[model samples]
Target: MNAIPGARPPDPKDLVRVRDRLTFLFVERCTVNRESNAISIADGHGIAHVPAAALSVLLLGPGVRITHSAVSVLSESGSTIVWVGENGVRYYAHGSPPSRSSRLLEAQARAVSDPSLRLAVARSMYLMRFSGEDVSKLSLQQLRGREGARIRRLYRQHSQRTGVPWDGREYDPDNFEGGSLVNQALSAANSAVYGVIHAVIVALGCSPGLGFVHNGNYRSFVYDIADLYKADLTIPIAFDIAAGPLTEAVGSAARKKVRDSVREFRLLERCVADIKGLLSIAGPVDIDDEELIVDDLRLWDDREGTVAAGVSYEESAEL
Candidate 1:
């Protein structure tokens, strides 16, 4: 399987085989087999073995045993498995999970506070608005102004630096003839990044709508966090990929391009670092037993112009 960026590099963990189908397993309860080193998923009564090479696996029912050949196919095809159930979704890294920490929250906080980082995010967001890719440009100030002025400014700046055209029109999911494949892939990558950012923000106990920049009546904070990623990482990488070998036809190829670009961008690792850095700058706030560092950032709530006080930076770091 193609390697997932930020996933632990493969190692000699173990190798084992499963003979039965298992289902209804919660993510927290799942474990990898020590002997075959494959993932052994189980509900209370049934069990199944997923080959080690599978990029992603989703358990849809009570009993599902993935055969050795299936695993091989997934590995060779570089496909990710997704589990869909009443509970929630789970993505299994083909190898190992990265070390856990509250660092990403902290970095997010820092990115918002720091001018350079914040500008980076703004630039990235702007680029996304036009080409739907992450390619860095000169600066936010250099871009020309128009309706959705903030967005236009950012995109113009990005275009200036990357030499990619700034198409002010809304994204046309139906039209793929004119746009480059890299542009299409970058857009998909941006969507994925946005999803992850929102998930991380929610995981930290912050509302996604409330944000410092890109304010809206809905989940603004999600946009805020997404904004930070643009400059520091996403924009440059998006542009790099768009300008690279990948083309814009959607489907399996587009999906693969997005995955490959994400890995090549090292977005996951950079995001983790950015979150940690941002939080460290926000400082600490006192909670009951522990200290929570709340950053003075605005988030998007359902109400217009409403800002909720966030958890302390240190507190979010602990999440």
Candidate 2:
């Protein structure tokens, strides 16, 4: 927490809290720059400034270009950057806080690394999705099978309700159009869901690579968290969109609808709480709320750390 002589400290309300911002911002074909401390995006014709720090996730879509300085500033401000293809189908790369706090990471690693604890967490995650079902004795394989069945049933129920043809889940990332309209819509919807989950995972300072049910991919944890909401949010939305008359590109409409549904349902806040509950992580993880004392953070290994000059802050004050 840094307090300048004349420069007033940031009010907790004015702080760039991720939960208050849009779930995620998707930008395409723009050059990112830092004008003073403000982040701006330009696409030749015009320029627009964006509050990058206030954003939870910044999805850099096709033709996006960013400078090293811009990246550094955004990273320092605690925004997660993800580079993806059209409709967020192909994830090219991403950058976020590698490790926010050793405590959370250690806790996550210990739970995920241990066999018994890992399975317990997996069951807990499943229970969160199922809500009321007891998965205490369900093995990982049994849990997976049950999950698949439940999702299939959801697809059927939604299909019947919306009057869309019910087809099994099928998607080919390479040939997206090869599948049915429903499948295409599902793909687009799920991609947007993954983007949000990825941002939250990074912001919480947990390793995305460590997943209980899902494994191998870099975004296993993202998949795990995103799956919890898909049946309720994405799946139904996809069917509704696919059922209605199409006025635009299928993928575009699907993504737009999915985003709208996410916002309406307040899924961003839900995602944060769900992750905290699943990981058994206590307390809040709001980085901006913490007093940013350099010595307290222990940034350097060899050198003695000192507080940033001309910067001190108080936690609470008189009205």
| lDDT for each residue of candidate 2 in 266-310, tens digit (9 for 90 to 100) | 887887667767666333334432322111353332345434434
lDDT of each: 0.42, 0.75
**Candidate 1 lowest-lDDT run of ten:** 15-24
- Looking at model 2, the pairs that clash are 1-292, 3-312
Q: Candidate 1 local accuracy as lDDT? A: 0.42
**Judged by lDDT against the true structure, how good is candidate 2?**
0.75
Which whole-number lDDT from 0 to 100 does residue 316 have in model 2?
40
